[model samples]
Target: MKIAVYGASGYQGKLVLTELARRDIETVLAGRNRARLEEAASAIGLPDAERRSADASDHEALVSAFRGCDAVINCAGPFTSSGEAVVRAAIAAGCHYVDTSGEQLYVKKIFDTFTTEAENAGVTVVPAANDGCVPVDLMAHILADRLEPVEEIITTHVVVGGGGMSRGSLRSVVETIDAIKAGGLAYTDGDWHPGVPARRTAITLPGQSEATPVMAFPVPEVVTIPRHIRVRRVQGLTEAALGDRLNTPLTPEIIESLPEGPDGDGRRTQHFTYVLDATGIDGRRARGIVQGPDTYGTTAVIAVEGARRLIAEPAKPGVLAPAQAYPSTAFLDFLVPHGIQWIIEDAPAT
Candidate 1:
């Protein structure tokens, strides 16, 4: 099956192209820079892959780039500014769409604005189908459904030792820093409240004896988790310093001054864990923890694998959370060979 990798020359996009190559999947390298796209393909040993120069602002070019593909894995973002055009192009091309966005606002926008048109075009638009979004959503469903109609679902992400941010990642930070403060958005009693506190200060992640200090940070799961489970509330948290780091104002010049991205060895040094807790109405609780290596590396797998699943079978069209598009168990299990591990267990009496 043929898939298109938009922003194919960027760090994450090239990683995705590498994953597709490993899977022996045919791909189209699509982005604004035809030279960089060609370089990316040659670097990945896919010298024969078609290179399409489709700038995000050029709608017609984007559609043409994706026209014959079964799906498009969009790796171009700070999605807030340019995402809609890409989504529109994918739908117009009548192809399934997935993107590696970590922005909550972008995720919400896709679900809100594209649902009708995506369904009408019979294309599944899965936004934030990446390392940060998908696993947490899937794990939330796996845990929350067991205690359906739960009072709350809390998701925390702990990342230890990773290469510094890529320039593109830094750009996303510049795009989202203001909105990410104070926990992004929280789902409460059937309504989403923005810029709220996490109401939690410390949490003990799985396998840790001491609790790590945490603060509310915007995570895409805040938009996704409540959709599948009957939880009255959902909140997301990450390390306190991480949440605080958003305080550092990022400018285009500052991002350009940073390193291009991590090398393969630096990427391999990253390890991430998602701890999802679901509390039932009766105060009973369960927690699911998904652990994996390499944040950007895993994202490549998630995006490519997500595209493969969408193209493998048709799902009811429209916007879908990652778990909504694929089975939690199957997808999580699929990551077993990728140095990923996870488990669900009863939360200790509190």
Candidate 2:
């Protein structure tokens, strides 16, 4: 099936285009710059792929660019600002949409604002379709089932050996400073709580003996996991050092000074582990961990796969969490060949 890659001139967009090519899927490159889209396409040997340059402000152009495409994989960010227009245009074009957005509030906005519109238009929109959200959300569903009568779910992740952050990624970091500063929104007792304290101070990463000290980190699972899973609480955690790093004030100037993105070797050497800890009302507990490769690369894979599923298998049309849109086990199995391994088992409720 044919798909459109909005922001195809950017880091994650280029990665998504590469993955689509690897799968032999036809794709149209789209962004605000035709020349850059052309360069990105030619760099990947897709010189003839359709190129559509549409600034996010121009609604009709985006719709035209996405028209005739089965789905659109959006890699644009600071999605907090530039995302809604693309989402609107994709749905208006009758194309299902998936965006690599990790901004907690943006996901909440997409859910709150587009659910009814997407449902009426019979279009699916899955935001935060990235490494962090997809795997953790999927595993949360998996573990919650095993930890039935689940009352709480805590998600944490660790990444090692990353090349560097992309300019867009860094800019997104600045744009989403509010969520990052607040450690993200938390779901508790059937309501969302803001500026919550770090409920747990430390969590053990898989393959490590000692518990790593952590701080509340913004992860969209705090927003998406509760959509399908019956749970009272959800929160995200990451290493303390990283939290301190993000706590620094980041501005456009700082982001502009960074490299465009990680080169192939930089991406290949990176690895990550996402862990989901679930607590049931009965005091039974379970944990699931997903170990995978490069953060950006894996995010591209997740976004493309999610879009492919949205078009081919088709979930009930509307905004959906990764797990709500498809079978968590099936999706997890799909990741196996991509260098992702995961499992869920009983854990002591201590």
TM per candidate comes to 0.97, 0.97
lDDT of 2 at 232: 81
Query: What's the true lDDT of residue 340 in model 2?
Result: 93
| lDDT (Cα, tens digit) per residue for candidate 1, span 1-350 | 99999989998899999999999999999999888888898888887889999989989999999999999999988788888899999999999999999998888888989999999999899999888788888888888767877898888888556777789988987877777664688899897888677768999878789999998878898898877788898998888878556777788988888777888888888888888888898888999888888888899999999999999966679999888899999999999899989889997645
**lDDT of the candidates, in the order given:** 0.87, 0.88
Candidate 2 weakest lDDT stretch, 10 residues:
157-166
Model 1 TM-score on a 0 to 1 scale: 0.97
* Total clashing pairs in model 2: 0
Q: Write the per-residue lDDT of candidate 2 for residues 273-306, one digit (tens) a residue.
A: 8888899988989988888878898998899999
lDDT of 2 at 137: 90
TM-score of 2: 0.97
Off by over 4 Å in 1: none
Q: Which RMSD values do the candidates have, in order? A: 1.3, 1.3
